[model samples]
Target: MRVVTMLHVEGELDQSRHAAIEHAVARAAGEVAGLRRSHLGRHYPGTVGGGQYTWDVLFDGRDPAALRQAPALLELVEEGALRLDTVAFERQHLSVPEPGIRDCVKRTLLLRVLPDTPPEAVERFERDMLGMPRYIDAIRNWAFSRADPELHPTPWTHVWEQEYRELRGLQEDYMLSPYHWGLVDGWYDPESPQRIVDTNLAHVYCPAATTILGWEA
Candidate 1:
């Protein structure tokens, strides 16, 4: 089981405080039970969502109740360093080729399931999306879950996360995968005129160096 927490920070960044914040987060990660790895970072240039920073924490496996009152986390909130925008599902992995996914290139999608869309359609979309890893060999990891907009400062209702070996694989292999174009594209295509999802808020991010087993030092 993998629990990912994405923290969207508010206010301007003080570059000097970055180290302090990260150190604090590391301390929190260590103190929290079931937390195996943690990564904190800001969006890359041109990334869609405007969050100044993101904290991706991977827990080994824990009940929601235990995670909710994590002491180090509460301390950060109490200290005013972070805000709660969205706390989506602790992702249940469907296809993970390996355990060291922290080093993979990651893409996070903030999905908006339309009001008029039928529940069955949403279910089918999720079913198809999860099936991608089976068809696209380049997709090393994939997970997603429904989101609660009220829990987030943003308007999205679903979050899609994926991992790949390289940027080119995201383009040449996964994008070109038959499962994507044949089944998934129509649900998001604007020209179709009845798109079920609003994809404007999605973005890609790589884990920072401080994250356990992340690509950086």
Candidate 2:
């Protein structure tokens, strides 16, 4: 299972403590049972629902032993130094496989689909999302999946993630794409009849020195 966690830091964490925090987290990652890979970094400029830092952990399975969070992270949360919003979802649809790029940007779209929306309409919305890469050449890789409520409950029902060569790929190619504005926009726009998603969403992206969303496992 792939666990994507976005944290809203309550205050400016002390610069002196930064290395300790990172080292603690890394140590925990190594000790954790099923954790295979992990990535932690500050989010980039273009963001919605607060800029926030992000943490991605890939687990071998849903075992309880593997799910334990780092002590440092728990301390921060317990001390009210950080706020968290996490989603655990399996990679369902993998379209546009990683283009073998080491330096890239990964963006995550976490949204809540209206519960009353017809299943057919929901399916159509998903199809529209998956079709975006076809029209936007800048998208290097992408993955879409429904969150597992049993594991972690949240208002967000789906996760749409994508990778790009740089911030421009998303700021320009993605935002300005005709298909994105013309067809896909309707599903999220309240004024449109096709609207099915709630306005509150977490659309954030950050720098990635190595593939996170593009990982095969």
Candidate 3:
């Protein structure tokens, strides 16, 4: 299973606290033998609430056991900074599926557009584009919504993650569909959405091997 840890700081995090936190994180990484690959990044300016800093640490492991030991690693950070509000989840068990471990291509895209637009409309658009009958077939998973309240640093915006599977059969079926469009633009409306701010896309690769830690349900 893959695990994602979200840490939100209540106020401006001091430099001292930041250093200690990073140090502890590094130490924990060293201690966890089962970690296959880990990535840590801070949320961009528009992604968090006012006067707060958010960071996400992602761990890819073979099994739940590997993630079970994650808290111990986080405890090290807590001991070092003592100034953070943290939440964690075994990604596969959480609301959002763990794209890192699933056999699919993972993509995270940040979209900032007009506010007050119902989420249903956005979801509908995505479904229409990705669900088209005549298009290259790809095992795809998509969701759209406003950013988490605690994580929305800016007003009137949100982020989304999309997953596509590279299955030859699916791809062939998509090609025969009438809705097939050669380019991504055929699906996503960059301007119609309006109020554009920022956009980003990432292609994620899932490692073949993983380690399981002692995790309790």
Candidate 4:
């Protein structure tokens, strides 16, 4: 089973405290026997929502109990620097139902692109690239929206969220397949400009199971 834990921190956390927390987690990442990979990062400037810091940790284990034993993980930062006002964690167990095939699960990847050209040109380019036949199977559904001022400051940015059922070899296919050619062609527009913001990608593991940690009506 694979667990994806998302932690959101409220308020402005002290730098020293943040560093301490990161260090602790890094240590755990190295020592934990079941951890596969872990990522910790802060929200982009001008992002919406209250939580400014987010941490995503992935663990390959039978259950979440394996991660619960790491006491010193967040202790140092919690001592006097910051308090965890809110925490959102989720776990998804990985399974292969068939004899030779892995169970189909939902995985979402976020892509933030900044084109050197005009918004319309960029949109056209994306449509042409993603409209390719080879990519037709890889992309389940996608949406493009401008970064809201209340959500982010990146101008004319587009967010691509893609869902894949099976991605074992899709990464390579996406890089060298016909899809790449389409991207190159679309990027040839004269209006292409330098990107102002960094691109961020997050891998979220989705299973047949889910639980809501916090919600309000």
Give the poorly placed runs of model 1, Cα more than 4 Å off. Answer: 11-14, 31-36, 50-52, 58-81, 90-93, 100-102, 147-156, 176-182, 208-217
Mind giving the per-residue lDDT tens digits that candidate 1 earns over 63-171? Answer: 5334435676676677777764444454444445554654456666677877878989888888887787888887666666676433333466777776677666676
Evaluate all candidate structures by whole-model CA lDDT and list the values in order. Answer: 0.62, 0.80, 0.39, 0.40
Clashes of each: 1, 0, 21, 7
Maximum-TM-score candidate:
2
Candidate topping lDDT: 2
Error of 3 at 140 (Å): 16
lDDT of 3 at 199: 34
Error of 2 at 14 (Å): 5.8
Query: What CA RMSD would candidate 3 show?
Result: 10.7
The 10-residue segment with the lowest total lDDT in model 1: 208-217
lDDT-wise, the better of 1 and 4 is 1
- TM-score for candidate 1: 0.69
Instruction: Give the range where candidate 3 is weakest over 10 consecutive residues by summed lDDT.
Output: 208-217
Pairs clashing within candidate 1: 85-152
Candidate 2 TM-score over all chains jointly: 0.91
Residue-wise lDDT of candidate 3 within 1-217, one digit each (tens)? 3333344444456777666555655565566766655543434333333112222334454343343245645564445533333323333211223334344433333344445556775555555544442243353444443443342123323333333454332335444455644433433445533323333322122211221111111
Deviation in angstroms for 60 in model 2?
A: 1.3
